[model samples]
Target: MQPKKKIYIALKFIIPAIIFLISIGFVSKKQEEKLCKKIVITIENQQGNFFINEGDIMDKVTKNGREMVVNLPFDNVKLKDIEQRIEALKFVQSAQVYRDLQGNMLIDAVQARPIARVFNPVGKDYYISDRGEILPVSERFTARVMVLSGSFFRPYLEKNLLIDQAGKDLFNFIQFIEKDKFWSAQFAQLEVNKSGMINIYPQVTKQIIEFGSVADYSEKLSKLKIFYDKILPDRGWNRYERVNLQFKDQIICE
Candidate 1:
């Protein structure tokens, strides 16, 4: 082919490509300039927890008694800022914010699941999330979870409880009960004494479970399970006033 013909073919393709690129940029700029017309908030409550509601999330996204994203331009709406504001709520585990092509802002939030409710001796009450996050008790809702009460957990009210080994052990012990179907239903509360010994209370039974410290919790629980499965069936649930699993290779019942 001749040099002029070759140049003509190259220009034909390059010119259209440049035009398409510019058209895309212009459309994107127009989209950004458009005003947000609507806001949609969705709260995921698969766990049936009502700690936070739609109104609470809207309050966080609103400023000065107005919705931040509704009347603002797409470019001015900070999605990350909105997300951070929603996630700041004690019950919200995570939040996501974004804009749709229809000039509407959408927010999706997941609420935290409380594994245990802790009532300290100093009158500080809180909830411990499954991820070890300390959450404040909500006046609107109460979770049906295991309870923890005692002076041993009082120091954690003012500081990060999950940072220390003792705290971690306590959290792990709660997790163990929460994970087990039978134990979670049987046990209602765990009390830590001054000497760091743990006593568990059952919902149906009248006996106290002297679970000792958090050390060897798995083995202790195993023994307790055996007692329930084998001994309780024959001796009856109320046969013993207290069941001690602190001893090695022996279950002391009284």
Candidate 2:
């Protein structure tokens, strides 16, 4: 091939590649500036009693989110700070604030899912979610959250009411039950006694099944399955006054 012809072909490819890169850069820049053009805050569990307010945006989104806006430009707005503020909200479970491809800022918020009501020894009770989240028990009790009474309640992180490890474990267990369609509406209350024994009270049956501690939780749950399928409905769940699954090998019923 001729040198001039080869050079022309190279230029053709190189020009297009550069133009494409420039276009992408421009698009990205616009996204950063256009983020949050119209802020939309949707509360999934805010009504009657939950303390979710416009002021909750502070710890819920970070810094002063009320004053923040979209299409204003990314240089002026701090993304990390805004995220922190939104997360600070008590009812907010998770938050993600980012600039979309078109340079539009979208603040995505996920509110915590409340599983039960926790009564504390400190004379305080709060709404407990399957994700190990807690909402203060204020004057409002109109929401349909179930109640949980136990010897153990979650300890919070410094000044922040985020639940601790034990609370998180309890939350995971509740999530497991709710995820299963068979047991979703069966449970009414989950109680932890003074001896750290875990008990479940089903709404349909007045009897309480004593589950011992969090250790071997899966094992105890498996035993319950057998009892439910093989024993309960066939023999009548009322056959046992107190169902104990604390032992390693067997379930002893009273």
Candidate 3:
């Protein structure tokens, strides 16, 4: 309870607290000192528009191609705005932006996948993906995807994409089929009959495979595999020009 003893105890606690505070402040100061001088941005399948918009935290930063080094007075530079701006492109599917300890920023993203190539009535040819999506041509991004033919082939209107009930059914059916792993790579194109019936044409084998609808894509795909692995490999593509799997658990190949 003596005054000097009480003072010494207080000094022991206060000295350590002050030293801890000073160490934290020094580390923080060093982190801020490592602030980046610029920001780097790169986009894939960008058709020439490469400028990140203003109000972005990365503006006025130094750019070395896609690598941006942002000059930050603080330890962090918020980059959500910059990412959103870059991903606003109709062609861009998703965008990711991040900053390292050195204030270096990176933008990486993958474009959307196109499902079907369409021949619109406007005499313009474009591609439409599985989500009922449509887009113009791209020389740089022509995927080895599927081709579709029906009355649904046309320009993208804000209205309905299907020309009739048949087109809609066929689109849905083929989209599911396209997602199939065993059959998708083997299939080349899909054609819709006026009766809303679906068909699968193989990439290696040239034949018209008559599948009813999306209802039996899994089953029909299995049958198609048998036709290719068991029959087509031995008999050649011309052996079965018309492969029909309309009946239950049966594949009638002619």
Candidate 4:
């Protein structure tokens, strides 16, 4: 083949490749410029009952300042950093920050579901999430979940989550009551005494349920259910001021 003909053929391929690369670079630059326009925050509170709002997430994103990431360059907005900031919120269970194809910064977040609220004698309040995580109460919103009070020590309150065995037991108990249709509405509060004995306060009946310990809670609660469904209706709700289910196999009514 002639050298001139070889050079012409090489140019045909090289020129298109250069044009393609340049076009790709231009399109990418335009897309990035579009992404730097505005940020869109979307809060996915699936149940609509969770405490976190879009503003709560935005507060973390901006740190209550405009220059942080809002209306800033797309490359400057770190999705991982935003996610970490949102997840740091006590109520937030998980968060995801990303950029869509439309060059818009999108933030999706989920709030932790609180199963119960714990009120200590020292006036400190904490929320026990469904996953057994202990979170501080929100200042903006108060969750009307089950309230637990009495004798929780400092060690239990110091951590952001339940680490001790006793705390875990209490967490499990509250979670169980919250999940159960009959118990969730029936029980109003849970009290843990210094002796680690658990006491349940009912919503409807004045009778106090003495649940001694957390072990065998299912069996103990089942016995109590029998008393409420079978015995209480016939005997009258107020007939027994206290119902004890601490024993091995007995529902002692007094």
Best by lDDT: 1
Candidate 1 backbone collisions, by pair: none
| Residue range with the least summed lDDT across 10 consecutive positions in model 3 | 51-60
Q: Pick the candidate with the highest TM-score.
A: 1
Candidate 1 positional error at 142, Å: 0.9
Error of 4 at 170 (Å): 2.2
Candidate 4's residue-wise lDDT over 92-141, tens digit each?
Answer: 88888888776677877777877788887676688777887778877677
Clashes found in each candidate (C-alpha, N, C closer than 3 A)? 0, 22, 10, 0
Indicate the TM-score of model 1: 0.83
At residue 173, candidate 1 shows an lDDT of: 83
Please provide, for model 3 over 1-254, each residue's C-alpha lDDT reduced to its tens digit, 9 standing for 90 to 100: 99999999999999999999999999987876578644555555434333223223233232323534445553454467656755665455677877666656666754555677764545666666445656556654465667766553433333334656645666676677567776677778766544456676678767888877656666777787787779877888687689988787887978
Alpha-carbon runs more than 4 Å astray in model 3: 1-36, 41-78, 121-123, 128-133, 153-181, 193-196, 230-236
- The TM-score-based order of candidates, best leading, equals 1, 4, 2, 3
- Shift in Å, residue 69, candidate 2: 4.6
Model 2 ranges off by over 4 Å: 1-37, 40-80, 98-105, 137-146, 154-172
TM-score for each model:
0.83, 0.61, 0.58, 0.82
